[model samples]
Target: MILFKKKPWKLVTITSTLIFIIFVVLVMASIIIQISNYKFDKSQAKRNEYIISTSLLNSGLSFEVAKGDINGIESIINDYLSYKEIHAIEVRKLTREVIYRKQKTINKELRIVAKTYSLLSQYDEISIDGLDKVENKEVKTIAKVVITFSSNYMNKKITQQALFTGGLLFIAVMITIFFLYLFNRYIYKYLNNIINTMNSIKQGDNITLKNKGIYRVEELNAIYRSLQELSETIYKRDAQLKDSLNQAMEAKILAQEAEQFKEDFIRAISHDIKTPVGVIINLISMIVEQSDTIKDNPSLSEKVNACYESSIVLKEIMTELFNFEEFEQQKLIENKTKVNLNEIFSQIKSLYETKFSEKGLGFSVYKGSQQTTQLLYYINIDKGKLLLVLENLLDNALKFTESGAISITWIVKKDSLLIQIKDSGIGIPEDKYKVIFNKHIQLNNISTSTHQGRGLGLFYVKRIIDLLGAEITLSSKVDIGSVFKINIPITSTMSTNTENTLLLTEELSKSNFKALIIDDDQHTCFTLTEMLNKYGIETASENIPEIGLSQMTKESFDLAFIDFHMPNLSGDVIMKKLTSTLPKNTTFYVCITAESSPYHLEKLDTLFHEVLEKPFDITDLQAVLQKALKSKRVTNEVINNIKGKS
Candidate 1:
């Protein structure tokens, strides 16, 4: 077999070729031997004929012929003819006279003739008869003999020898070929098996060769044993790796579960802490709002204001703590609502105007051109997150600035809002701009300032900006001022008059607008009732959701404030039951919650018409009332339109 034609150095091919050449040589040698033997046999037969003729002359056969003794010649010839090879013999004198002749019948075509000549002479005796003696004897030709030999015997002998040699050579060659075939098959079988095993290994099969018998060749057997050992080692290693991987996966699941438990614990603690904190802050805020009563006592007002400020700060710290954990976990929920930039701007102005004046710093807000103001800047955005980002930036500015002016400028472009907060304070280095946005990173030069913080303000701002898909860049020089420019992409916009036309007058108080407050916390119910009563809206408070539901069924209220978490029934469950039976578009349901968890808040957002986070002041309450009033007006308008059509 031609295993590899390109590489002729293979052992089997070389050996087979050599054997074939040897076989051809042996065949040629046999033919040469046959030819040489045939010639040798023919030559031997000619030599025998010559010897016979010469012996006759030596025995004086030629003299016998001269004496006319034909019988003697005939007897000698007859003796020679007794041999089978000599077919015929003839004797004649020198003058061509036949002395004696003998022949045997043989195949004429199978006979070969040979000729022999003999000379005869007589020597004179010295003195026995006293005759003349001659020193030199006279030589004379007496007779010649011709013999015919049969070639058939020589031909048969040569053929038999040739046939014998050829038969032996053929047998030897066949035996050699058979042996070579066995050797080739044996080598190929093991070699192919080794190659197949290697290929299987390459294909990721752990094939064990232990069951296969050892090879006769020591080298091949050793390699096979090594392969078996390697396969076993690989299998063991794979099992170990799989076990390790399974353990690692189990550990990872445990770690995730622990992390979830930690998050839940933090959320539960925040809820418990924030509920009372919200109540305290709101109650203090109401006390602080009673300015007429406290204005006469400066000492009392100052202490109350200090307490109010401290509580506000504590609330802010708690909020930041919760926000940090939520942002770290990437679990901050985004709730987008239609908001007015003017209102947000007004809030910011109200919050920071007094603080900046106390610091002996100039504060100014530029709201762009008159045309920009005329177009209602109503945009869909997460209002709380945006406020957080702005507050962080402004707080950072207020903290860093000593006595310089701080200015805020905002403008509306085609489909985006751009705001810039510029502060004439200690500026940041160019290299530190990007680094300052990382959590817990601060400028080293400014680390000793009295207003130094945990370095979370800008980081929080960056996280909120990124969450809102907005862009903020800072430009600053040392000892100069810094300007932070922010560009927020607006997904949607509206151009309309967003002014609140609802006026709170005696007519509105007599309008018979009623609101329901359902909360498991009596303090929250009382707070909400007091806030609603200020708007001249009649309020009924229920601590139990079941009682609230029963009250709701008996009387229809224009507005209902429901707490998210309750003992018997949750806010969502109550809302679901009431929404089915209550008149649609008549009652506005608001969910009040102290829980800061995004999961719970997201669920409540889906179930409630409005979600009011706790710790809100009169401004927040006023906003909710305005919305309820707007909704009631729309419902009344729709009803009147239907009645008129009918």
Candidate 2:
């Protein structure tokens, strides 16, 4: 049998048990008191017997003996001795003889017995007095009065009191136990609820105790109120923090848009500058190539060659700057696809072979010895950007190497592709190797006469490789050679064909198509119209979206180039209006602007036939125009067939 270990049960049981024990002890105490009272009652009865017998013997018998009236003495003794509590009584004269004696039970020295205790007789001596005579104060005992009490006289009464006390004790214990049980259920249990709730909350158990009945205690109510306030405070602070973070994010996005605009302006200016500089450089090249006409003066021819090279160098710097801007700003999104390393290398080899031949340097490409025969040199990547990086490295190798060979080695590992472009040219100094990749950095040992680039080639290469999520390392010695290694992580080992990006199609391959240009900028609209006219495409221009849309609604074109950021109406809204009202055959939609956010672009992709980013070249423009023409033709065919069936 286990005693209660829980607090409520323990309190109830201990209290109830203690009350019961106290009741039992009190009952026992009461019994002892009753027994003591019995003894006192017996003593009192003995005292009464002594007084009564002495009075009767002294007054009644003494007077009678003096007056010679023995009848009265005998009557008093007989009357007193008739009491039941008086066990025996005796009256003796001065002669030591029993003059009057009465006995309920025979005994020499009287003893009375109750159920569990005994009582002895009491004796008292009485003095005799003469009737109407002088009192003898010094006289000895004349008569004796003796009395004994029956101890069993009040035994039944005492036993009844003990029984009554036991009954009261039992009732009290029961009532106390009832109150203890009630305290456990009503008070202690709820207290336990509070304690248990606190413990549970301390352990991070989410719960709520309704203060409906639980808040009966004022102190507990105060505690609960404080807890609620604390939780509310924390929640409010958390909400404020979240709101602050959201505001910060919005500010960052706005700042990003501002930066994006600046980069877009840079891109447009670079493209505009590149086209004219390219023409200048080409005209200078023509002058150099046809220098025989001017060979009458070799000094002038040499100066013209210098001007051509300077023009060419200027064009190269502009192109490199534009590429660096694109990479740095992440404006050029990578269009990744499956590619064959062998094919990409072949193209790179062909491109570098021309440069190498011009420079009279040897160049070759091969798989590294570490590459396994079982492995496939297939990787998914942005083929154009990857080619750009290889081109830059190979170009650098050509520039540095005068007569030595440049070798490109690649190894297809299980997880990555390792490519190294090693040159037997003037190697970089050990300390300058890392800094060689920095923008505008030139080595001391490299030839100064043929360094046409502005030292941005390696920097641009590194940034482009970073955009590819690849790693590049350079190893070089002062006079030996430099090895530039690039590691590209492989996503899959499955064999794949090289990706071909041929955006021109038959429908719009020719430049004799009609097009509409819509933009807010007058210069941009005019420039685009001029460019399209140069391509032999009949072009219309509108600087406002409303006018552009109105023009489109009135007169149909083969393709409509709408700017996304217009005055009142956005490009997407225009697409929606056109999609709803305009016949699919009449015009094909094209988004042509600098909206480069992925979210906006993805949304536009669903609406436009194609997205033509701003600052694109003639080739990019041709590709988008071709797509637009193809869609327009397809839509027209579908409608014509539908009309024919109808």
Candidate 3:
């Protein structure tokens, strides 16, 4: 009852009230009809007295005889047998209300009448005074009837009516219950669907109400539709919020990338500047301080050597920074040239020989056997950019190798040259090997007191190798050692070595040679002309390409130097045009570049007698001039020999 079963209670209440009310009406109708029929039978028996009295008179039977005459009544009853129930009759004399004389008899059928009421006095022939008459007493005569009849038909009629009414009520109750059951099923089904849908929503599932037209209950379907609308609204709101969150996350990521870019830029600028300043300071200190032990005022040549060495180191760092950005952006174009492995490796060894010896660490370089790798021939490459890559590797090795040996070895594999830089140092962990080439990835534990790398060296190596369509790999174990390997595809070769250049400082000051210097920078041209004059070479210079070309064609010069970069027409185009027009001229062509062109140096060597990088030492300039003079001498000798043979 506490649960308040509303539907079931309503079904029972309504059906029971109606069926019972109908039951009461039907039962009361049967009872009233039965009672009325009994009364009618009683009145019908009472009315039969009049008929009997008249029948007795017609039959010549006296009233006096009916009181005591059984045979006479029998004769009368036989004559008037129409009164089937005239079993007996009594005529009684009463004084006011007292009975005086009373008689009773049986009919011819021997049926006796039994009266129901008691008389106050009975018939007494012997009274209080022995049959004496009483004065002032009035006497009257009355008859009584004793009637009995069968009520089988009346009872049977009432019984049939009750049965019929009860049957109708029973049918009505059953039909009500059946319809109620059907209604209950509909209500249960609708509620069950709603409950299941609510559960799904509560469980965080997306839901939609469907097939509602099939349900018969309009209100329930309306509620269901409203629920469906509500669910859709919630889902739409949730989706919008989720999208907003994702956009926020993307914005955060972009901001982080910008910050990282800024940091990388600052780090690059500082790292590039630091190494060169240290080298310059150290070089100057060595020249000034150590010269006192050499018994000489530091010669111009010594100071120049110091400046050139510092410049070479500074140029290398800057080039690495440029290549780093270029490679990362995939903007570094390929400039393939024949690279003499022997010459480049010899230069690297010489460059690091003093440092290694000072550190008391051994450095060795090896070339693979002829059967293993073709190391003796010139391989194609971008010498200048690749030079930075090797420099980075060597610097890393130098920073890590304190005591044990460092080795640079190369073997020609099928389709590629595999170069390995191995070092015995505080090695990297094996797990960190994969990420070691990622920029900013570094190890704290190493050979040096302070590790000087910004962790971008290997990253630059990886990118450069990838640009060259090659691969790089690393292997290491903590406290053991590490080996970094680079696989470079072999490039096609085109040319051989050029004239040998040697430093001729004293010769440069004593001799006079006419030279033409063409450069885009006016200051650069001025500096070159002044320096060449100091070296006893007569020089004419021009920053404009047209003027320089005119001077070159007009005058038969012994030597000409041109800067590769200019405002509009590049030095390469100017040189090709000038040399083509003056094919037979004895003037030597030289390319003066601000950066190393090791990448294309071999091809450039075939084009120009010599290549000079900017911020040149006096010695390098003398070497270029000496090479030019030597080639002229050799050419004159070959010409004379050819003329004699002819």
Q: How far is candidate 1 from the true structure (C-alpha RMSD, Å)?
A: 12.8
Instruction: Please give the CA lDDT of all the candidate structures.
Output: 0.77, 0.66, 0.63
What are the models' TM-scores?
A: 0.68, 0.43, 0.43
Model 3, 1-646: lDDT tens per residue? Answer: 1123444433333344456667666766876686677667656655664444333333333343435555664554444443555433333333233222222443454434343321222232323322353442443224332233223334455567667766866676687678668767776887898899888776656797785432344456567878888777777877787799899899889978986786466444533443344335334534544566433645765655557566667766666665565555555666665555666777788777766777898989888774323223567786655776888888888877768888898766666878899988778887777777788777656524477666788887777777788887888776677898888888543233242222343454444468898886666666567557655777888989878888888898887998766667767887788778988888888987654333445556667877775545443465567677777678779999999999
What TM-score would you give candidate 3 relative to the actual structure? 0.43
Q: Candidate 1 at 539: error in angstroms?
A: 1.2
Candidate 3 deviant stretches above 4 angstroms: 1-305, 369-376, 411-415, 444-449, 492-517, 526-540, 544-546, 549-646
What is the C-alpha lDDT profile of model 2 across 1-646, one tens digit per residue?
Answer: 2233544333333445566667667776876787688778767765765565445534445555445455776786577667767666555555656655666766565446421111112213435432233345554444555555565546566767777876876786687778668755766766677677667655545555567643344454566666656555655676787799999999999999988788778745754564456445545644555568667788888788667657655655565666676656666666565565766787578546756866778888898675444543566776656867887788788777777899988877787888899998778888886788888888875737776667878988887777778899988886678899899876745532221223233224353467888877666666666556544678888888898888888886887888777668988898888878774445667787554444556788798877765444444565566456657667769889999999
Extract clashing residue pairs from model 3: 382-599, 383-598, 383-599, 384-598, 384-599
Q: What local lDDT score does residue 390 receive in model 3, on the 0 to 100 scale?
A: 84
Question: Which candidate comes out best when scored by lDDT?
Answer: 1
Best by TM-score: 1
The TM-score between candidate 1 and the true structure equals: 0.68
For candidate 3, give the lDDT of residue 407: 88
In model 3, the Cα lDDT at residue 465 comes to: 78
Candidate 2 accuracy as lDDT? 0.66
Which candidate do you rate higher for lDDT, 1 or 2? Answer: 1
